[model samples]
Target chain A: MLSLLRPGSNPRRELEAAAIALLLSIAIGSLLMLAAGVSPGRVWFAMIERTAGDPYLLGQVLYKATGLALCGLAVALALDAGLFNIGVEGQLSAGVLACAVTGASLPESTPGILAIPLCLAAAAAAGAVVGASIGALRAMRGAHEVITSIMLNAIVAGVSLWIGNEVLFQGGTTRGNTIVEGAQLPLLPMSGSSVNAALVLALVVVAIVWFLRVRTTWGRTWIAVGQEPAAARAVGISVARVQTLVMAGSGALAGLAAANFVMGHKHAFEEGLGRGTGFLGISVALLGRSHPVGVLLAAVLLGLLSSGGLAVGDLVPKELMEMLQGVVVLSVAAAGPWVARRSVTVVPEVAA
Target chain B: MTTARLMRVASLALAACVLLCAGALFYGGSAYALERWITGGVALAVVGVACVVAGAFGSTAMRIAAVIVAAAAIAGAVLETATHSELFVAVASTAFGAQALKIAIPYALAAMGGAVTERAGVIDLALEAKLLFGAFTAAAVGYASGNVYVGVAGGVLAGMAVAALQLGLALRLTADQVIVGVALNLLALGGTRFLLQLIFHEGANSPPSPAFENTVLSNPIFWLAVAAAVLVPLAMLHTRWGLRLRAAGDRPEALVAVGASPSRARFAAGLVGGALAGAGGAQLSLSVGGFSADMSSGRGYIALAMVILSGWRPAWAAIACLGVGGAEALEIQLQVTGSGVPRELAPLLPYVLTLIVIIIAGGKGSAAPRSLGRVS
Candidate 1:
């Protein structure tokens, strides 16, 4: 089970395959750009120059990466337990709502230190509740997590809309009131950038997750249950309990992503906060091969593409970037089994 | 505990919950509530209890009887909640029925597509993508050429294209079906949105295209969908081809012993299913007279759910689709009638109902295809 949890191939080989996939996706994207009557080279050059050369643009990448990394880690955690957490979108929505509500309710004079942690904790708990419900449904009702999670997404959308209209909406406005100043994370001392403390916090999360997964018995047991439930059961592990626990942990991680938008940037919840970021996390997990370190790198790469896509919207439509991301994920999925087969044949005699 | 006993207990619990909730609604001190509606709720609860008793103590016939009574009870509840006029109830139900038929056309077609493909063992999670691509191409072609037939053909071909991608990835290369399906969905969304923007210069909707606006009885696609639904089951039960398809999914080695390739059989099934789903999509866009990115919404997923809820059978799948459509139509009617249910929560009824039905059906006991998600 442990062996199955870890990839058999060397890290170098996996890295090489990832790089190739990225380049191929870019190539396909360029062809589409050409067909659309745009010059890919000019667009690529502009995107790179804007994102890498300018500090403000770089800050934007970091800001986006903070959210993506947390969500990516959330997905990786679920994947470690052999579960697909498609409800991350719904979970994140609930989390941001909880964070905003709690932040807004706090006294104005509350210390930033206490207020920030309280808001984050509230978001995590809210997300965990949502996640645990789906887990319970899967365990007790014989429901597929995929279908239930998707259903929860629709339910969350309706609930969020209702809450926004009835409870959160300020008088004559469409959005909730802003959080108190004490609850907001302090921004980095940089000119022309809104990058806040979330980036540092995201990195800390990544380190902690990595340690838990590699250096703890609990993580091993979770992975064991995921890889082979029947064997785990035979060995006296309660598969249901592990699944529920991992799912809650996964939800909490995804909920923490709300901090990037609610506390670090917008300081209030509204419709479309970090829209599509949840789905993007799935792709990042796949690209990173569901490893903590790999998820971080993939999130950063996607952050660059997204921020650059926005910067170069004039030269080529930003929709192209979206298409490219989809193309990359598809190409990787299509190639994964074949690559795994080849690597297995090459390695020869690895114990099953 | 044995699964059957577990299911029986769950069904009993559901019945008890229904009765308890109904009793609370009827007897609770609401000053302005109607007596007739409360009586109707109690009647529904009685039928639910009868079903639970049959499930616990009766034979298969009794269990089926219980299911029928439960279904009727649901219909009664909907009628009571959505309409108040006893004199006009008949008239209102006719209108609601027509709306349900209209809403159900796409679902029936899509669910049929799902049922057939899943029976052959290649998971069709890309149904959503196929629907989106089909809708877009159908609208675009119809608008450009001024012929509905061309549009329909475009839709069919577009669906086949998406199926071909699934076939290559899932069958040929043996990629994870779920992952490939998700990727295809994302691709379809992005690709369609990009093209819609590029050609229409609009972010949301396309120009109005020609459409079939005939009454339900006169609509050709509606009949086509119904015929497909009826014939698929007959074909599955009586035909040699049907046997081979089932064999391919349930016991591919037996199929291999007979000198037939399971992969080829699955490929053919996927193609036919894709075409049907595409027709559903084409009909959707035509009904609305234009294409919108969010038009299909989650109908494809709902169709997938219907297949499971129906226990992998075609006729029952059709029934499930009608139920979902009715639920949706009732939601709309409730808003029109000022039934006082929170409007924001009304749209979620169909999805929540699907989840409940699946849970009651007891998960893996739904008689799924044996090798459904396995790679050959």
Candidate 2:
């Protein structure tokens, strides 16, 4: 999507591109709903009414959004470095297992301050190991990160499944043993929903990402390397090191998503835990256009859509929300380039 | 006719007849020891041909080793066919061959389509979307119309429609092909379920409908797949359309030099490729009796992998599909027969093997189109 725009363009134009994409998806989604014999207005109203009207549902949305935001940040950061990290799903899977195992192994009387960070650190470290290995493959061996990441994802899935089936969940049940109680993130005041401190962490990360992108030299270095690798190399920047580091950073952020699931929601590593969030991160990053603020907003909007689909499930299939995300990304991608091209052509006329 | 010319014709006819008879007897069992003889004979011939093909690649030592392995496999298969023909017949029976064909056909078709799409410089990751749309439309239309052929037409058109969307975005709108492709696949999965709910009033599957009597014997789409597997690469090497398509992938500027539009050639490639892929989708539904939502099950992606692994050759992609199908079939057999590898791990063999092969082969003499994934 960044490729569709001018390098280092005004942020407002990028916002406009994202807005146009959203509006287009809304229009298409409404048409689909109408075709399904559902009243679009009522459906949307019900969706908003149930998802955001009730504190419980709103809390659920927030819980979902926390993970999506972290994942969005991961993908957005990688996108900024010109590395498409489709392996976020795999990284998150690794993190979830590691986090669960770490929490389970800690003494039963472990304190929150000690246990939580240790588990989270284990998650991030596991994820970084996966993320950096793929990074090294792309950096040193010149393999396309996309293919290697996908292969890595498949491997992670197989290994995780094997471990989960054999070692973690020894009983007939598919769910793993619970983490120490101290390691769990305290639930928010919302009615019985799993919203917790992870939401705060996600928001903090968003702000951090914003500050890094706008104010940090390292951030600029990655963007520079992304845009012009040879030029960066001419300036004595190590492109390989930067990419590998950025990818590892991306993987760690994705790993942070496990806190929301393991520490807040499930408190255990379950098979099929948080499935599809990694791919949804791609959608968020694309829809967000790789911006920190944009990613945060996109994550909330998508989380609302996911929860809202269930809210309005009786009127239309919840699957429509999934389709809507696809429509959103495709419209965004298609419109990005066309709008940019038009803007380019219009600039001369403006000068005249 | 001249005596020599007639003799040559007679010899050719005789060879064809023997091949057909052997293939029939190998799959369709016989009363006598003749079945065993035919099975062994076919096995040896297949292994011999494999050895010759393997000889085309690898160092001299590797080639020699592969040949020795091929010889051992051939001798083992023949001996097994003679005494315990159960193993050979299990793999080569009419039922098993049909199942493998069913498994391979859709993948082969999609892979061939992927070969054309990627070879023409468009990275087609949404082969799934096209195939899914094809399958759903074929099932829906075929059930509604009670006419299988018309349903197949609907599927083919559906595939082309999806192709046009991809091309419009990737080529005209200059969107990122991989992103568009991925988004389209997600949309296809969800959209098909949405449509299924709307049309069939169910999300899981559609009602069963009339289908082809025999895919191998009578299905037009099956023959089309066969033709695509055999003819696409030959056309790539020979035809004007083929040359222009290659140029579109390798050097779009060369087409401009010749006063031709590479975009046009690419569009042409998309049309042909989309239709074949769509037909595969139709075959999937029609052969299976109905469409299950998103039933292609990553076959389209695997087909794309095979396309890349085969270095963009349609024939090799089809062969790769066969290999994948064979592994899957063997995995099923292993579940029943039991094995050292966990039954759970058996299914991972094809995917893991493909990944390993790709890693080994990716760096050396990469044959991907020069301007691949670049929207010009």
Candidate 3:
């Protein structure tokens, strides 16, 4: 135990320990569930079957995945830029509100083509403003983006609540205004779930972001800034400018996610619509290692956990899935440094 | 040198008078606002004087003055704000005081726990998890045993278990502490909810605990808390363990050179922190007689803010917690009187005020601990 606590322990051993720890956490959770009279095997089977076996349920998972993917991509971008953009929750809320309000105000006779684009634009603009506020605060006043973003999220929640209650409340109800039909995103062909064109849009955005980050000069600048802001500055890069641009882009993606959720699925902004997605996005980014491909994979896994857990509620408590997800995130984070250290050791051994 | 000290004191005095006068003028523009304006002005004046005195003399005397001034200001402000001719006072007195106390005490305790842990060189961001675990275990065992004390003990034990688990990974496995902390919070939330649903056939909200009938407040516990608030700082500064802890935080290598184990110090600190936070959670359910899904209600986060505002000093944290608690109490009071302020704004007041405090403190660069957030 003392040796385990020492600083100079081998990285390979640490990774193995982390894997064991994760397995132990799962086993303990399962035992607790069993003690509560739940059949752990049945629960596990139900969760998997609900996610992959049924078409309708699978569609729900996909619908959730699309939103998570967009938000995950946003987080990935921000992480790559070394910005912890926790304000995605607020940005998403604002986007949903903007989409709903804009759609409600538009003429019923308006074409779906025009209305959809207009709503998307509105969401993007709102998100951009929020994202830029964080960037500007960081650049000009040295306020930490994490703190400002969190404060902004609270402010947004308050403002959204006020709007839902006071202004855009449909027919004097506390709920949000009903979105216009013309503004709703059209569903994909024969999908039982409300999977819409937004998935395609999200995919396009992901590709664009990936291309920019890996292929463009600006992307290289962002990577440079992320790695070492001081060194980037020494190399004549404008760190502040890059940070602002990356953050704005990140907010835009989150806003788009909100727009997709409201226009394609809910057709109305609900209180708590963000549903802890902002924080979950942090987990997704970390789990994905800030890579686009990794983000997509992580987002899908998270989506499966959420939708599958809900679908299998009769067999397993949904909270079990949440616990598992949290454990996975923790294990991954714990494993990161050890993995880095192990690679170092392996390279030296191979050279020898 | 004494002249220089006196000059510094006089300048600080002048600054305080100026700020108070300015605050009075700013808020006293309307006759209806005069009382609140004056109260706020005086409080600011007291704080300003305390700051200057601390700068001129030493932290020890400054801390004593802070406690006295804090108490006096709270009592005076509560009295004036509660009974002033303004209609807001009556509502504020009745409604805001109880509710805010209900919320603030738990947070203050959690923050004090954090203060202890951070001061001892361990990074503890799992306060929310600890709180949730305490609440969950207390509710479950309390319902089972039909004894609130047993529930409280169970909660503390649960918290210690979590601390031990986190320490195992953080200290032994060299896992990232923050990540583990966040995971622990999530696990507590999800695990508790799962158990609640499975066993009680209810959602996350458990049945109320067998409440302590308000006798605990009358018992020695309340006084003990107060005394602990006062003495912990002195103990921390003067005791050998305290010295080791501070050394570990400031310079872990130095502590190691002096034959102390940093990991051991951190483990002890983490356990103590967990226990304190657990007690705070126990106070919530066992004292209040009920449990809800979000019983902790972001107090864990508020405790984090308090740790920052208090600058890692336990006594200062207590003072900051009191101020926050007072503000919360005032907000509740205003709400009850049906003051002109919107109901939404009432709940938002503390958060907004804290944000402002953060901004101002951030401007001065004196709010947070210098060594905070670093691995070493």
lDDT of 3 by residue, B1-376 (tens): 6633543454345345534543443344566576676676676666556545544553443544553454455345435544644544553454445444455566767787788777765667678778888877887788889987788888777777777787777767566665666677666767677777777878757776687665434522244346667776776788876776676666767777777887787777778778778877777777776566767655665676667556677766666776677766666665666544445545654555444344323311343333444442
For candidate 3, what is the TM-score? 0.81
lDDT of 2 by residue, B98-196 (tens): 766667788889989988988888888888888999999999999999999999999999989999989888888889887888888878988888888
- Per-candidate chain B TM: 0.86, 0.75, 0.73
Query: A246-265 in candidate 2: lDDT tens per residue?
Result: 99989999888999999988
lDDT of all predictions, in order shown? 0.77, 0.77, 0.67
- The TM-scores of all predictions, comma-separated, are 0.91, 0.84, 0.81
Stronger candidate by DockQ (2 vs 3): 2
DockQ of 2: 0.23
Question: Taking chain A by itself, what TM-score does each prediction score?
Answer: 0.93, 0.95, 0.86
* B1-376: candidate 1 lDDT, tens digit per residue: 8644665566556555644444443334554456645665576565657545654653433433454466556556555544554422642667778888888988888888888888988777788888888899999998998888788888888888898888888888787787777788888888888888788876779898888775677666788888998898888778876887788788888888888888888888788788888888888887777899867777887888778767778777777788778778877766676554567877887766665555554345537888887753
**Candidate number achieving the greatest DockQ relative to the actual structure:** 1
For model 2 the local lDDT of residue A99 reads 91
RMSD of 1: 3.8
